[model samples]
Target: MTDSITISVDAMGGDHAPRAVIHGADLALRERKNIRFIFHGRKEQIDPLLDEFPKLKPASTVRHCEAVIAMDEKPSQALRKGKNVSSMWMAIQAVKDGEADVAISGGNTGALMAMATFCLRPMEGISRPGIAAIWPTLRSDIIVLDMGATIGADARQLVDYAILGSALARSLFDAESPTVGLLNVGTEEVKGLDYIKEAGKILQQASGAGFTYHGFVEGDDIGKGTVDVVVTEGFVGNIALKTAEGTARQVASYLRTALKANWVSMLGAFFASSALNALRRKMDPRTVNGGVFMGLNGIVIKSHGGTDEVGYKSALGLAYEMARSRLIDKIGDTMQRFPVNTAPPELPSDSEAKSA
Candidate 1:
C-alpha cells in the first residue's frame, strides 16, 4: 500500500474518450492521492486532456496506442483487429506486465472481459472468473457477483463467487465477516435449483471461508440489504441488474410525470425541490459505477461506456479501493477452503487403483 498504485486507464475506450476518462482520473485523485496512472490511447487525443490536469499530468504516464475498440465491435473482432495494439488491450496488458496494479476500461463489456482473460488469465484453481458489483440497498450497499462475466455457473463456481463477493464486501464495508447469501426463487428450504441448494450447503459447511452464510434470499431481499453478498449465476445476475436499472428509470419517470401533472403538483414539487435533488443524486447509477472482474490474477474494473465524468470517476475510485485491498491475493489465498458437492467426482489415481 505504501508504493504508488498504478492504474492502467483505457483513455480512448468510452463514448467520451480521453476527456471523460482523464477528467475522472483527475477527480479521483482528489479522493485518493497515491494513484499513478498509465494511460493507453492516442497521444494526440490524450495528451491535450492530461495537460489540463497539471497535478495529474505529473503523476501519470501515457502510452500511445493508435487503435481503438468500437462499442459495436464483437469481442472476437476487437481482438482480431487490435490484438495488443488497441487502447483497451494495451491498458489490460499493463496489469499482466506488472506495470499496473489494475486496469479500468469504459469499453465493450465482452471485449474487456475477452482481452483481460487472454492477457491476465484466471488465478490458479479458478475455473472461471466472475464480475462483482456494488449495489445500493435500503439499509446499506451490498455486493452482487457474476454479473454476466461467465454464465451458467455450477455449484462450485457459485461458491467461488460467494467467496469473491465476500472479500469485496469486506474491502468496501470493512465488515469483519460479511454475511453471504445465495439468491434464489424463494426462501423456503426446498425452493431453489439443485445447484443453488448445493452451493448453499457448501457455504454452510465452509467454516473457514471467512464469511457468515445467511442462506437463501429472494430477489426482493436484494434492495432490502438482506445480506452483504448475494451469489448467483451470471444469467440470473445480469437479468436482475437490468431489471433494477429499468425499474430505477421507470420510478424516476413516474415521479417527473406526477410533479408536472398540474399547477398544485408543480407547486408542491417546487417546494420539495431540494429533497428531490438529493433523491435524484442517491438514485443515480453513476454513484456505483464499477463492475470488478474478480477471481482473476489481477483486477479489471469495467466502467459504463456511456457514463459521464461523474460515473467514470466512481469507477476509478472503485479501482483504487480494490487495488489497495489486494483482492486477488485475498481471494486466491482463501478459495481452497470451500469445495462444492457439484464438482465431478474424482477418479482414483493409477497408484491407488493398483494398491486397491
Candidate 2:
C-alpha cells in the first residue's frame, strides 16, 4: 500500500454526468488529501468541470472516452457495444492495469458489474463475485452481501458471502472478529431452506474464520443490528435491500404528512426542527450510497445513478476507505481462512443459477 491512492472514475455514467461526478470527486479530495483521480469521459464535458474546481485539476487526469453506457442497456449489449470505448470500461480497466487502486461509477449496476467482472476478473477461488452494501441499523451499520451480484447461491456460495461480508465489516468498521449471521426465515437451526441450513452448519463449524457466526437472522434482525454482517443469496438480498429503501421512504413520507396535518403539529415540528434534521440525516440514503463489488480482484464501487454530488461524494469516500484499508487484500486473507470442509453436495433447486 502507498501513502497516496489513485481512483478511476466513470465520469459520464450517472444521470447528472460529468458535472456531478467531477464535483463529487472534488468534495472527496477536499476531505482525503492523499487521494488522486483518473477521470474517464469526453474531453469537452470533463474539461469545463475540471476548470471549475481548481484544486481538483492538479490531482486529476482525464482520459477521453467517446462511448457511454445507457442506464437501461442490457449487460450483454453494453459489453458488446462499449467494451473498450465506454467511460465505464476505461475506469474499470484502470484498476486492472494497476493505474488506480479502486474504480467507481454511478452508472447502470448491471453494466458496471459485467464490465468489472470482465476487466478485473474475480479473486482466486471465487466462483461468483458478490455486491456488498453498507446498511444502516439502529446500533450503527452492518455489512450485507450479494445485494444483487448473483442469484441462487448454493451452500458453498452462501459461505463465500459470509467471508466477503465479514471482510467488508472488518475493513470499514475495524472489527477484528465481526459477528456474522445468515438471513433466514427464523432464528431456529431447523428453519430456512436446505442450502441455508447447510450454510448455517458450515458457519457454525468454521473455527479459524475471521468472523463469529451468530446463527440465523431473520429480516427484522437486519435493522436491529443483530450482527455485524448479514449473508444471503442475491434473490433474497436484492428484495431485502429494495424493501428497506422503500420502507425508509415510506416512513419519511408518513412523518412529513403527520407533521403537516395540523397547525399544532406544524408548530411542534418547528420546535423540534433540530432533532428532525438529525433524524433526516440519519435516514438519508446518500449517507451510505456505495455498493461495493466484493470477491473481485480489484475494488469497484457503484453509486446510485440519480444521486447528487453529496451522494456521489459518499460513494467516493467509501472508495477511499476501502482502498486505504487494503480491502481486497483483507478479503483474500479472510477467504483463505474460511473453513471449506463442510461444503454440501449439489442440490436440485440451485440448477437455475443467474448472475446479476
Candidate 3:
C-alpha cells in the first residue's frame, strides 16, 4: 500500500456544507493513521467547527480561501469567472501541484468535471474523462461509466467507453477478464440506434484488449450483475443510475412498512432481524458513497451532495483505495497498449463555437 496518501476536500461543497464535510474528514483522519487532509475553504467559516474537536487540529491542516462556487452555476462560466473560488480552483490546484494524491468533492458536478478536464487533461488517448459509479448486483458489482460527463456519443466514442470501463473494472475490482456490455433497450443486435449496433461489432472484434465483450444488456438486467462493466452515453447512464436509486428507496420503504403492518409480522421481523439487517446493509447507498472520475491524469472522486459524516467517510475510504490501487496509472498504461479510436472534437472557429 502507498504510504500516507493526502486528499484535498472541498469543505464547502456538499448540501450540509462545512459541518458534514469536516466531521467526515475528522473521522477519516482518526480511522486511517496514514492519511492526511487539506481542507479547502474559508478559515473563518471552518475554524469554528474545528475548535469543537481539538484532536483533529493537530493532524489536519487547512488552506484558507475566500469564495465558493454555487451548485447551480454553469460549468464553463464558473471556471472562467471563479478563479479564486475555494471549491472550484483550490482542489484542482492541489492535485496539479502534487500537494494531494486525490481530490474529492461534492460540488457542482458540471463545474467539477469541467475544471478537472481543463486542469488535469485526459490520459493520452482518452477522448473524454468519464464518471464511473459502482452498482451493486446480486452476483457481483457492475461498473457504469459516463454517468453524466459527456452527453451524446458516436459509435467510436461508445467503443472507447467500453475500453475505459473494462480497464476500471480490472484495476478496481480485480476482475481477470472483465465482461463488457453496452446498455441498450433490448438485448438483440437490431435494437436502439445505429451507433449501438456498430459499436457492438467493434467491441466483439477488438483484439489484444483484455475485456470480454458480452454484447448488449438491457436496463432490467443491470441489477443482476450479468456483466462486469456497462457502457453507455451519459444520457442513458444517468437515467439508469437515477432509476436504480429511486427503485432501491421504494423497495426499502415497502419492506419497512410490510414488516410493521401487524403484531404477528413484527414478531417475525425479530426472528429474521439478522437477515433483514444484512439486506439493508447491501442496498444502502451510504456504503458506497463516492463515484470515481475515470480516465483523468489524477484521481478525482465525487461524493453525493446529500451525504452525511458516514457517507463522506466512505468517500475518503474510496479515495484511499483508488490511490493504493494506482488506478490512474493502470488506465494510462492500458490505453497506451490499445488506444481508443475516437479523439475529442477539435475546437471550431470562434464564431461557430457557441452552445446551441
Model 1, range 247-340, lDDT digits (tens) per residue? Answer: 9999999999999999999999999999999999999999999999987788999999999899989999999889888777667656655543
Sorting all predicted structures by TM-score, with the top scorer first, yields: 2, 1, 3
Worst 10 residues of 1 by lDDT: 340-349
Better of 1 and 3 by TM-score: 1
TM-score of each: 0.93, 0.95, 0.91
Candidate with the larger lDDT of 1 and 3: 1
Q: Which candidate is the best by lDDT?
A: 2
Compared to the true structure, candidate 2 yields what TM-score?
0.95
Per-residue lDDT of 140-254 in model 3, one digit per residue for the tens? 8779887989998887677777777888788879986789999999998888898888778777766357788898999877888889999999988998899989989998999
Q: Give the winner by TM-score.
A: 2
